[model samples]
Target: MPYVAVSALSHNGLIRSHNEDSLVIGPWTLCSTETESPQTLLFPLGTPLVVAVADGLGGHPSGDVASALVVRRLARIGPLLDSEEAVRDALTACNEAMYASADDDPDLIMMGTTVAGVVMLPRAVLTFNVGDSRVFDATRDGLRQTSVDDSPPPAPGHRTTSLVTQTIGGTVEFTAVHPHVTSAPLAPESRYLVCSDGLTDPVTDDEIGEVLRVHDDGKAAFELWKAAMDAGGPDNITLALVRVSE
Candidate 1:
């Protein structure tokens, strides 16, 4: 049987007054404003595993609430995610909950969050994302981004990308979230990373690949966080690294 080793970390970063990021790994879950020292878990290969990260949209009221709602919903729905349809349904339920909450409170109105995660089954891993938070596949070939960003590409001669086009609870009007989802066969020597934009905004893909190549699961996670902080930790950083083995 294959086995998976995982490590996760979340930090408020140097500039943020609060951390509006949430995460879940297997049975454990963390809400916004909660920080946990890096923790490692090992799962027997055939067991189902779910890991996720959510980043609250800055400049919005109760951003922490929005992000906390996302991961908590996923944690509740995690064990039952046995198929692609099930995953979609779970995400829809989360979206609806966010929308309903926003409708019920003026302070939470227009609050939104980005979500990215992976569900590991016996044979394959399913990856999904909404907004700019991401999932990446790391192997000897290179680091490939598996989740698509909802933001538009940067314009000519400009480094700035467009704002996120899709998210949970960004508006009070009825809107449907279409998450990007994909799957890949679980293979030895491969690693998957689920992270908030806080990590990617400061750390380049090549730099990420280099760190993954040089370290094991826990160390890689720590190094990634370090790199982001070294780059000034402009936002809240949250990530999970999962490594597969036979």
Candidate 2:
């Protein structure tokens, strides 16, 4: 039988004071960790498997708290995310919980996070995201972004924009999110990359593709993280590589 494997890592990056990012793969979660080395896990094919990253919104209070909250929720509900609607409903619950947390605390107002990842089903994979975090179809041929970015066009000479159009929870008033979710057949040797903007902001898709072409699995993950650090690692870095193997 085929199986799904995920190699994940998280770091605060060079500029960030601390890691506000969080990760979830099935029932496991990592919040505010400094894991430059990749940690890999394997899961059987039949059950639902979720691998995701939640990047806490920068320049917001309790960004860490917000990200941690969402990823933990994802971990708890991972096995049930077999369809797009299930993923959407889960995100809605997370958004509501974010707002409810803020309402109960004065300092956590406006806390928010961007999420992106893939859900591995028996025969297909679902890619989903909100805000600027990303999901990518990584193959030897090239790297293709599967998740839609919620940010507008950047200014001249700017590689990226910090401003995002939507997120899980960014305001005192509750805001709904239109998450980007797409499905594709899950063939053997299939691979996907899920990450916060920390990896994409400084590194170009072409550069990332080059790395994927040359390396694989944990090595690919490490090389990508190195590329971001070489580019001056501006924000909290978190990423995961998912592959379906026989």
Candidate 3:
């Protein structure tokens, strides 16, 4: 059977005092099974795919906690399903998990994170997001964004960016659940890049595509982060590269 090759890393950028970004790669068992060892924090590459990045709300208390909780919830997903609906359901579980954590900690109220991830199988690619963090499809023609930003588009005469209209734990209302989820067929020779705004906000899509085109997936992920840091590294940087192979 063909397998997905996944590699990821998170860093505190030039400006941030600490990295609030979190990532989850590989099976949930790996995360839970080695709690007492350093391996608890890392996962091996071969298995049904689950790779994601979470950017904690910058101003919120326990922002790192919020992001880590969300990714951990995703890691816990077992008996994994490859369909789009299952992906949505999994996200819902992440939302609830974040909320439950917030409920326990007074300081964490309204705390949330931007989540973007991909579930890949030989037949398809299911991509999702719940904030400005994004996922892109890299094709021979170029890189095209796959998920829509949950934030509103920049308005006329407005110079600054806006917040995500939907997120994992922004509000208590049930209908506030993020509606920006979509999936489509994975193109052979096509490469998927899932990242937090740390990378996109600083680097151009063309640059991202060019890097992937020139390097292997693991190196591509690293080069992308290096470029962002070179460009001043304004925020936390993260990138995940998943290539569909023959």
Which candidate number maximizes TM-score? 2
Q: Indicate the TM-score of model 1.
A: 0.94
* Model 3 agreement with the true structure over 67-90: per-residue lDDT tens digits: 888777777772384677787888
RMSD of 1: 1.7
How many clashing pairs does model 1 include?
1
Which window of 10 residues has the lowest lDDT sum in candidate 2?
A: 136-145
> In order, what is each prediction's RMSD in angstroms?
1.7, 0.8, 4.6
How accurate locally is residue 157 in candidate 3, as Cα lDDT from 0 to 100? 67
- For candidate 3, report its TM-score: 0.85
Using all chains and alpha carbons, the TM-scores for the candidates as numbered come to 0.94, 0.98, 0.85
Once all C-alphas are superposed, what RMSD does model 3 give against the true structure? 4.6
Candidate 1 lDDT, 1-246, residue by residue in tens: 678878899999889999999998777787765354678888876656788999998987788898889888787778787677777787787889988997788778888888999998888898988899999998778899999999988889755463889987778675888877777787766689999988998899999999998988788888999999999999999999988887
lDDT: worst 10-residue window of model 1: 29-38
Q: Whole-model lDDT, candidate 3? A: 0.72
> Which of 1 and 3 is the better model by TM-score?
1
